[model samples]
Target: MKKRNQYSAEFKAKVVLEVLREEATVNEIASKYGIHPVMVNRWKQEFVDRASEVFKKGPSEAEKALEKEQQHVAELERKVGQLTYEVDWLKKKSDEILNRKRP
Candidate 1:
């Protein structure tokens, strides 16, 4: 069995752009890239179909993920601060107890 070739997103976009440019036939672009002409056409169609997504307004998935991570970090920082205060209070109590016992 022959292994299937996988093309990167960048390469597919480049081929699709060439197709859209009308500078060459789909077959010519495919031949240049050693890919199937059908794949090139599909990419071009998909690109056209989703082109509006480029202008859709809102925070992207990456932005949402970053916000979630920042919230988590803030919660962790608060917990650390609480724990440090508790540790300091315990140490002070322990030191006072030792000092009283020494006298």
Candidate 2:
């Protein structure tokens, strides 16, 4: 039994690009590359799906994590500020009530 041939990414991309450009039919490309038409179609689909990612300027994984952490810190700070305000209000109310009773 012979092992199946493994095509490189560059080679697959070239064939897929040719298919995208409509320079040749899927059957023609497969015949030229000696691969099955289904394989060519699959590569073309994958290439098209990831075409947008090639131009995406989104941050890396670490940057995304840092942004998320920063957001969490901001949320915690806001909650702390709210709690502090509530505590101060309660303390002032208690003091006013006590003063009225004493006077």
Best by lDDT: 1
For residue 66, give model 2's deviation from the true position in Å: 16
lDDT, candidate 1, at 56: 81
Best prediction by TM-score? 1
Estimate the lDDT of model 2. 0.92
**Per-candidate TM-score against the hidden true structure:** 0.59, 0.54
Q: Write the per-residue lDDT of candidate 2 for residues 47-96, one digit (tens) a residue.
A: 88878877779886678999999999999999999999999999999999
Candidate 1: residue 30 Cα off by (Å):
0.7
Which residue runs does candidate 2 get wrong by more than 4 Å?
Answer: 59-103
